[model samples]
Target: MKSKFLAMLLAVSAISFSSCTKEDEEPPPPVEEPKVYQLPGLYIGTYTVTQLPNLAPLRYVLAIEPDGTITTEGLGSDGKTYYQQGTWTLTGTTVKATYKTINRTSNEVTQSATLTFNEKEGTLTEGTWKDLVNSDGYIDGKFGKFTRVKDNP
Candidate 1:
């Protein structure tokens, strides 16, 4: 009778342990990684009018939005803040921007620029700034180079 009672106790303990394991334990939850923010299509940076000595290098924020909108902005120490906005298209390493620029005095000028992106130098090379409607060039065909500016990643 004692041996029979011991065997019954052992079976009961085994059943209890197995049921406790299945009911008490659960799977681990999934881990989520952090998301990173990124800039738009165009390379934004600072541009210097190499031909003009009196003007200082200004910050230029150029971006082509998802809806095919183009934006070109720059600030000068000479009090000539400019913003050029319109449509942009990219082909290979080259970008063509046909936009209108407005200065601090609200003088509007129409222009077009064909610029090639130089990845090695992190700059925009072979930039040709021209006035489409007027012979008197506002940028004066003076666009030469636009070096990339580094910012927080």
Candidate 2:
């Protein structure tokens, strides 16, 4: 009876030790970090002209690259198709886009606008695109809202 009790105690001690050893083992490998999206893709969204009287709503699809290249596609006056290629840059809260008119009889224009982004809300608020050249040219002064779309075509 003494030998049997000793064997049972040893078995119980072994089981408890093994359980503690397994618990002390390292956890599974840490999860891999997610990849960050590069800022060199097309962002398509609508832009509302908020200024009074000229409250014209426009739909625009713009492609921006990190190398300061920009391409915009949208409708223009006379109800015809319009496409323009330009250069763009982001400095702090400002975005400047300079585009040369593809069609003849149009002026080359440079527009500078302020931008405010809310990461929590995933929203972008854009100020009016002001003409850099003409002092009295059409200054939009309009505020537009845009939402980021994943896999924007």
Candidate 3:
């Protein structure tokens, strides 16, 4: 009888201990998935003109489209409209583009810019822009920090 009771108690203890398994303990913290960014989006930033040293910076919003088209339009505090239409290429961490800036009077000047895309920080940095054509126009400057505001479209 004692042997039977001892066997039954040991079986019960084994079943109870098995039920308290690592599975019953809190599940290992959910594995986190890596973040993916839709590259084509609105990059909002400012540009400081190299020629006009003391002038206010020009605010720029670059709309990068997936169709290889990019555009930007802005009205400076001096009441001049600045516009850019061009195509962009992304290789590794570098974003390069060449666009034509259309002033209010319809005078278009070609310009090119290069920026470093920082995926970790969600920003565009180490930017530089230059006028491809020396024609009278805007957009000869280094870009300020650019932040991705909208994703896609």
Top candidate, metric TM-score: 3
For each candidate in the order shown, give its overall lDDT on alpha carbons. 0.65, 0.58, 0.82
Which residue runs does candidate 2 get wrong by more than 4 Å? 20-38, 48-54, 104-107, 117-123, 133-143, 149-153
Q: Candidate 3 lDDT, tens digit per residue, 8-56?
A: 9999999999999988888788999866665588889988878779978
Predicted candidate 1 versus true structure: per-residue lDDT over 31-80, tens digit per residue: 87654322235555555554576776566667656566777886654666
* Model 3 misplaced stretches (Cα beyond 4 Å): 137-139
lDDT of 3 at 65: 94
Model 2 residue 109 CA deviation in Å? 4.0
lDDT of 1: 0.65
lDDT of 3 at 64: 89
What TM-score does candidate 1 reach? Answer: 0.51
lDDT for position 137 in model 1: 43
